[model samples]
Target: MYQEITHSFTSKKSLLRTIQNDNIVYYWFSLLFLNKSLRATLSQNKNTALSYKEFIASLYFRFILVFFLALFASAMLFHVFSDIYWAVLLPVIALYLSAQKKGFKAFCNIFEEFINQNFDSDSLQKKTLYQIGEFYGDRYAIHSLVDTLQRNIKTYTYFFGISFVFLVFIYPINTLVTCLGLLTTVLIIRIYFNTFSLLRHLQNNK
Candidate 1:
């Protein structure tokens, strides 16, 4: 009886560890591939006949579709391999990362083209200065930006709130993880913007 109980406990622990590891891997892989796909599709379709906003929306939907498909594939692969899932996934991920680098460069070119077409040098410079000021200590600019951000946030908040409530019913653990993930993402974005603002300020002063 003692040996049976100990064996069962050990097996459960191992299964739990495997699931945790798989979840972590899936999260990162999905994030990276989705982001790259977004950039790639946008850049590739930038000069297509579609209008800018339409093109963006289409690409956004496509990326979301691809993300779910890839996720399903990964889950299937994980189940099939049982023990060496990462080994199979690593090569595919590497190839994806390499392709994404080229796509990212293309995306950067599209951005440059857009800026060149839409924004004159002085206007662009002033916009940069304003962003820097807001980042540093300009209360007025900060307030203005915050108002704009808040409006956008409200839209996402509704969607996320609904999703969280649903997840709570189906998977409470996922709901908690999702909340923490969102918080971390927000913090990282805040830090990145602040750092970019400081760098711009330094460049202007020099």
Candidate 2:
């Protein structure tokens, strides 16, 4: 019975989710500026092109890599501190999730209302608008999640750097130093690819 319960518990938890969650930490540590700016822009742009459902739904994910890269470079140059790290991290993710859910709910409500008011599929504008609304709802949630990840990536990188650096003073730090060098080579390639992907996506959109 105990063995069955244990297996059940483990089976309930997804390894993919665990990996993605781990990745979120890395992304948060890497992308602070993009997180802040993009979230803010979304708020300020109540009537922007991105507000359109189809446009956002189709392109919500195109900017996350850019945001991540922005965060990474910002961290390398600005140097993220350990102070208030936990306080900052949890609230950001929570707030983003709440905001995203609320926005999507509102969009869905509006779309439904419009459809009820004019059950006219023949009108391309009405049909497109409703479709756009549905798309926007999807894209909004995705964009919001990406923003949360972007912020978390920076936070993760900062924390990781601090933890790794701290180990240097406490023990035979030579090993860490060597490891960091090797990791740097790997990170260089990863970062380069990330940048290229962002540029390519952006250019494609343009």
- lDDT for each of the candidates? 0.40, 0.39
Deviation (Å) of 30 in candidate 1:
20
Most accurate candidate by TM-score? 1
Candidate 2 lDDT tens digits, 78-181: 66643544445565545544544443343333333433343433342333322332343354333333444445456546655655566555443578675775
Candidate 1: C-alpha lDDT: 0.40
Instruction: For residues 58-117, write the lDDT of model 1, one tens digit per residue.
Output: 334434433544665678766855455556556655554444344333333444454455
Clashing pairs counted in every model: 0, 18
lDDT of 2 at 165: 60
TM-score of each: 0.34, 0.26
* TM-score of candidate 2 versus the correct structure, residues matched by position: 0.26
N/CA/C clash count, model 2: 18
Candidate 1: which pairs clash? none
